[model samples]
Target: MKPNPISVVTFDLDDTLWAVRPVLLKAEDIVFDWLEEFAPKLTDRFTAKSFMKWRWDIYANYPELAHQISQLRTITVQLALEESGYSTAEAKTLADQAFEIFIEARHQVLPFETAIPMLETLKQHYRLGVLTNGNADIFRLALGQYFEFSFTAEQLNASKPLPEPFLAAQAHAAVNASEIIHIGDSLEHDVIGALDAGLHAIWFNPDDKEISADVTAKYHVNFYQVQCLSDIPAVIDTINKSRLHSRVTSP
Candidate 1:
């Protein structure tokens, strides 16, 4: 039988509601251009790809910094300069400059075409919220109105795949976990994390990647699969109808 209708719907910001790669690429270009112009000494050591690699490596090494992307970017720039033979003071200055350039550039966001319309539809029927590991200020990009609440790992000090952030989102939304539906692209982070927190999850698997054997092996299950934002309303209707039937049949 189908489960209860979701009363609250929380979404992952990056790659789920929007196409983040283009915005990130534009941000990187702006940062690199600034570094090349103002901090030419640091430019030689830091390329965008290498910078991203180093940032991810640092996040992996210091799991505590997982939600601190800004800090990770800053440290990555500093480390790149030091590795390329710059002194500590010089690296620090370059890192600060790079971070400023990146942050200002990142504010120029281009939300996906479907994002606003879909949110408008969902907002009418369900409480809407955001669950992310990114900087909280990201809402300043002009997508804040649709959500009644937004929670990030930085605020909770715990990233996804850990249940804290999801639970935190539930608290912030003032909704029970079972009544919340989470939508995200990452199987490990979104699906597993929401499930761990007892929220219904929907895998936004636009890429058509086969379900992993490991996920299947663990017996993890999601409430639905959505290939596009347009599919959401239908899925919600299905869930609601099933819930109505279950209620009617209960002894």
Candidate 2:
């Protein structure tokens, strides 16, 4: 008559839940079309290379805003427009509209085939949450039903690879690090950062990539990892049973 030891599990949204590349590519295309129609003169001067330069420049100047990708992107567009000969006020207005277009398109993602079917089952066992660096809105996509809370780098002011978000998750659950686990695609951001913050981690390695030299050290010993989304339920069961057994056997 004991409660589950693993009370919470947080997930990364972009590459973990869906393929990010196609969505981003489509979002970029949407933005390009919007710009051509709304600000033809700015589009005439705009190039991908120049857009990247402007974005990186914003990163350089405002390192504190580094984790807030939405703001960074908005400012990038704003600055690029100003440089392309728009008045500052017009630049800001057009930049906001351009970002609105991009963000709407960004949410049109195709979740991995296994993702939704598995979520209801997982939610029965663990209080699930989302922790993402990207700006995808779960509520808009109707994915909020599967999760109890959602955290974003934009809101946290700290992305993955930093301990802040993981620590925040631990605090949100009001539990020790051992009671929470995170799963994501990035070895550096997901596994390493979670472990560094003392939370358990699982690498959702759908691509079947090998762990690079340094990441293989302590992480392999400390956490459960999976190569496919379909494998997650079994992995979580193993972790839950292992934790339960340890607690029962402990003196």
Candidate 3:
């Protein structure tokens, strides 16, 4: 069968392009340190580690925050400040400023060595965009120049492994689902989710994690894997060529 030629390449920002955990850990520390100096009562009441746990607690208690990551963060900070004895207005202002500090630090990511070069190559032939559940603003980072658009869970009102965000991306790119390829570090959110939504997927497994055989057998169509960032464009080229060969040989 002739492949639906790929046109739009969508990426999941967080762990796919860079190590998100370290970035988040550092951002958390920055936020807490800022709070320690400006809102000492909050720091006195809770350590940075405890503050992180409280943030998760708020996320767990509020189902509505599943897609509103920024709001969840802000609310967590505001509530902590209020509990630490700040007035409502003061807490709100402090929370907003604290989140700004966190996000700025969050953007200070160290991408893998070949990430930029790979994006540069891919962007020449494909329309690149971002689809993420996290708050990693691509435009805040140097790599944002390559992406044509970015869709967050907060903006789309749905998060992966849900199909809504994938479908929304397909619509936004004005391309058939089969013509789009989503690359991410997640098995469920990136590979299965994209395949389930009728788009292709490339699993960006830098750690070379094992995948259960059953998972692979289930969604074999248009699913691929790559351990190195530089291998992506080549794999994509192969997908198209193999499909073309199949088209020529089919009886």
Please tell me which predicted candidate would have the highest TM-score against the true structure.
3
- In model 3, the worst 10-residue window by lDDT is 215-224
Deviation (Å) of 135 in candidate 3: 0.5
Question: Once superposed on the true structure, which residue ranges of model 1 sit more than 4 Å away at CA?
Answer: 1-4, 46-61, 82-90, 136-138, 217-221
TM-score of 3: 0.95
| Candidate 1 lDDT, 158-187, residue by residue in tens | 788799878887787776788888899888
The Cα error of candidate 2 at residue 78, in Å, is 0.9
What is the TM-score of each predicted model, taking all chains together? 0.86, 0.94, 0.95
What is candidate 3's lDDT per residue for 118-224, written digit by digit as tens?
Answer: 99999999999999999888998889999999998999879998998898889899988988999999999988999999889999998889888888678755588
Top candidate on lDDT is: 3
Q: Which stretches of candidate 2 lie over 4 Å from their true place?
A: 1-4, 48-58
Q: What is the C-alpha lDDT of each candidate?
A: 0.79, 0.84, 0.90
Clashing pairs in 2: none
Candidate 2 RMSD to the correct structure? 2.2
Error of 1 at 232 (Å): 0.6
Models sorted by lDDT, best on top: 3, 2, 1
Estimate, for each residue in 1-251, the C-alpha lDDT of model 2 and write its tens digit. Answer: 44347779899999998999999988887888788888888778867556656667667887877887888888878888898899999999999999989989999999999998778789988889888888887878877799988888888888998988888888888888878889999988988888899888889987788877676776788877787787787787888888799779777
